[model samples]
Target: MRIVVADDSFLLREGLQLLLAEAGHDVVASVADGPAFVAAMREHRPDVGIVDVRMPPSHTDEGLRAAVDVRREWPAARLMVLSQYVEVSYAEELLAAGEGGVGYLLKDRVSDLDDFLAGLSAVAQGGTALDPLVVRQLMARRPDPLAGLTPREREVLALMAEGRSNTAIAAAMVVTPGAVEKHTQRIFAKLGLLAGDDAAHRRVLAVVRYLRAAGG
Candidate 1:
């Protein structure tokens, strides 16, 4: 996969480039700060973009805002945010922007290199890869939207937010696919997602609802 690495830290930018190169992916552009990241993204249009939440000049949300801009310009852009802090509002905004190939992972929580690579691959393939910590923070911040769900239903919802398919969720839970489907239906129904909604639409809707409930 061709990629772009964007971060304010020189070491991190080089480290990610090296890691991606060793993993058989091309780092087409390595940039520091947000505007350059956006320019590189427009020029390279990489398969996936890895970015930190903060960047130079502001050290606030430059990279995140850049990701939003990139997504706005190219709706199909695949982006994965690597940040030390959750930055809840923008993270929610990023997730709610669109459904395809989006991820937000905490830098410290990514202890397993293989798992991190797998998550990146998942996002590049138009799937989600929400970090469990991010999910937990969102859930902890809001309780009203998910009030109707049972514990089991909530478990299924969390996995759904992580972009896991029913088969994968079933394997993780050691349950059958049919059982996973039933739980998913229950989740959708409780979340007010109509049965007539397309499956993928409903799934993303359900996950977005969880994120939207997370207060800014």
Candidate 2:
């Protein structure tokens, strides 16, 4: 599979290129930051991308997010996010896009060449892979807010945070206007949200919650 690497560390960047090359995969581009990663992907059009979760600028979820944007526009591309720390939250977002053709693993797991290669192969072939450590952390959580919701409800909330009103959310969710109102009420109650409280002004807080909350 043709691949691209995005990591701020030069050693890790170069090492990955050499290792993937040794495995007979082309390393089309190597970038040191999130913006550069995006540009490289557009320039090279690699089949798969390997990126560190925290790279450059905020050192937050830039890499993971860029991958998501790429996936939205290029549905066929495979993505794998690597991080040194065993963080469950990152894994959740990486898998949130879709289970197929995606992966999230701790960087330490790369030491096991056979196993690491297996993960790359899985993603390249439209399969899913998650580091065991990540799975363990995720299992510790009980209750999923997303569970048991109608597909329309899920889509509603996805755009709801964009500050859409009941009518707008209704249009986006493709349900009856009355149904959208009911679904929003259900979502607000389920998510512990309160209305008439100026919570709408907390959009940034909501963004971080969507991006950083552990099992939220």
- Per-model TM values vs. the true structure: 0.85, 0.62
RMSD values for the candidates in order, in angstroms, are: 2.6, 12.8
Instruction: Name the regions of candidate 2 deviating beyond 4 angstroms.
Output: 86-90, 144-216
Clashing pairs in 1: none
The best candidate in terms of TM-score: 1
Candidate models: Cα lDDT each? 0.86, 0.68
Model 2 residue 111 CA deviation (Å) reads 0.6
lDDT, model 2:
0.68
> What's model 1's TM-score?
0.85
lDDT per residue (tens digit) for residues 1-216 in model 1:
999999989998898888889999999999998999889989999999999999989898889999999988888899999998888777777887766588899897456778788889978977778988888877677664667889888889889888788998999999999999999999899888899888877887788777777653
Model 1 segments beyond 4 Å from truth?
165-178, 188-202
